[model samples]
Target: MIKSYFIQNKSKDLKSFKAMLMWIIIFTFTTILSFSQETPYYQLPKNRKQNHEMIVMPNLDAFTITYFLSASAGIRKPFVQQNGISPSAASFEAPANGFWEIALGQNRNDNWIYEFGITKSNNRLKTSFLELSRTPLVFTNEIEQYYAPFRIKKKILTLDKVSRNAFLNIGLGVSYLIKSNNKPIEEGKITFGQRPIPEPRDYTSLNFRIASSNQPIAFELLTEVRGKVSERLEISVFGKAFFRNNKYLNNQFSFTYVDGSSKEFGNYEKPISILFGLQAKFNSPKYYQYKSRVE
Candidate 1:
């Protein structure tokens, strides 16, 4: 009886092991089918009509250098002018100027772009007007000046394979006035004596002077449309407007036989400029990765 019982127990153990193996195979097959029916996130269709797209991937580090040239035109107010003259009278009316920029920085794939560079600009304007109608009159003056600015800017590019590149840039800068020239003026006063004699005296001379705080801090908003024109070359059209809370001036007046003094004149106001230019980019070989197809 003991031998028969042991044999039946052994048969029962083998049958139970076989049942477990069958269930394991069924579970694995179900899992495989479920996975095959679903699509992967990377295989999704891309929207090619958008200007910018967000990239999601592991973190990467990249470094690049850039150089650019541009031209701009804008309005500016003189920092100091004559006490009695209108601020507009000393205002710069011309807006045809040119500038150049150079930048260098590091990039992290499509995340961010930071750069520091220097810029130089010219300011020239011409207008005709009459001043000091009461005495010492001046007329038809042409003003020309140049400004040099040092600045730093930061930009973020949203990149997508199916769309064009778009980015936002914010910058802070400071500029110094090099030289300012305007039309010359001369005026005199007459005196009456017992013999009816005439006395000559010069009233005031107009000179544009830059102050110690002549350096102005400015800000700008920039937008651009970008695309890769070639394998290692990129082309873009960008626009920007610059502004500053500080003012430029025209002071240092001279009087005949009198002391020369400086007075706070007009404030530089409403200085606005627009730029439209093309930018080309050259890439290094290390910035790209090669992929292979398997049969």
Candidate 2:
């Protein structure tokens, strides 16, 4: 009876030991899984403003240069006969004005840019008188002008896959006429050379220069298509418009012949003009990296 009792007790102890071993294995596995699923104690904040260890840098964006040509729609004028001899109709033609500009630009925000720049421009005019029985008479005028413009541009479209952008800009400008020359053309030969001289006594006088109005205020508008050419360079083609409520850049001119006949040409006003141009913009890599960091 003692031997049988000892066997039963030994079996009970063995089963208890097996059950205890199973419980210990399950507990160890569960503890390991909980530890593996835990997050790190320290993490970085996703918001830039909330990050205390982040550095802030200045954002200086780009420098740009542009060259443009103007297109003017010529207007016709009439001849005034003093000696009872009315000549045939006269017509006025003004060629395109060429302009060059250099500007510095700053990114005002994600979709806007601001630019301030100076432009150099020159205007030329050609006038012809068509008489019934006489050779046509021609007159010419030339002027060099300068202006400063402040503009803000908005991005209308952005194509990141192609690295291209389109923008529209509007701004205000002031123009100054520095030099001018006007002369009559005889037998298709230009009479005088356009050169700098001492300030003429009548430089700003009425009817002496092509423009009667000087230093006029201008409103400017521009549209651009820009593409990235390299890490530091971008290329663009643009169209621009200017609205100046002055006599500047007018196709109109009045001249008197040696035979006492007077003629007036054009519509006597040039309120708006158009220009098309090419631009090259340079960027700094250091500033470009700042764009990536903030984004």
Candidate 3:
């Protein structure tokens, strides 16, 4: 199907077709070279097969750990799935992140990968105080921009043994925000990071309606596929999701107003919030070593 599609558009998409053709040739050549040497390469020694046959995943004759960096584009909604009232300041529409990965395992089959990532947003909601008087004065809302999403991930499913052409991997991760800006909120109560909380870190406050804690940890999951374009380069496609633990990450800023009776807001939090994103990855070989299990 794909071959015919490309063939049909060969004339119309000449440039694109040419580019695609070039990559195909490069990948084919690289695959041949990866295992071709005067003495032969990437072939398992007969003696070592017995020891590795019991393993669930495929093994490589010689392989090394892979390192990568990726850029992510996605969304981060409130911890609560829905709210009777909107957020006081948070209107997170687009979320972005940068991640680093360290992978260990057989290059062609499965591997254990460790990951670290950080996310943040520049969008801020601004509302102002209003007064109905002879002359109306505008009090623009000054909401702070929130960020600092740190995550750790582990890849459980990987199809690297087939990487001479393409590969796939799936992973799970988590994010924690328990330190730095931490506080509770009530309908009419104020939390940390809001005004008077001081400059620099005031943006991390809980001064919004239906707001949760500064540290409502979230769970993350991802799937990625890489296509070899050349011996040293591969292109990737990926999808990821983040689900907040509402049971532990509830809404703390879900409040209205407390004339004077309401002072202290409870410690309880408010619901499930989900965030997701998609990304493209560009990978290149960092280094390669010739190793043999048996001499």
TM-score of each: 0.43, 0.52, 0.42
Q: Model-by-model lDDT, in order?
A: 0.43, 0.51, 0.42
| Highest TM-score model number | 2
lDDT (tens digit, per residue) of candidate 1 on 16-48: 999999999999999998776653442232422
Clash count in backbone of candidate 3: 13
Tell me the lDDT of candidate 2: 0.51
**Deviating ranges (above 4 Å) for candidate 1:** 1-92, 125-127, 130-213, 249-276, 286-295
If both were scored by TM-score, which would come out higher, candidate 2 or candidate 3?
2
**Tens-place lDDT digits, model 3, residues 1-295:** 9998888888678888789999999999988776575223323343234323323223435444445555656554432232333323232221222332322222332245454545543221222212222343222211222333443334444455543355666777666543333234324433432445344422232233333334446666777675556544445566666554442333323323222222112222223334455544344443334444455
- Could you give the C-alpha RMSD of every candidate to the true structure, in order shown? 11.4, 13.0, 20.2
Candidate 3, superposed: residue stretches over 4 Å from native: 1-60, 77-110, 121-163, 178-186, 189-210, 230-234, 247-274, 282-284, 290-295
The list of candidate 2 runs beyond 4 A from truth reads 1-86, 132-135, 161-211, 249-269, 286-295
Error of 2 at 183 (Å): 11
| Candidate ordering by lDDT (highest first) | 2, 1, 3
TM-score of model number 1: 0.43
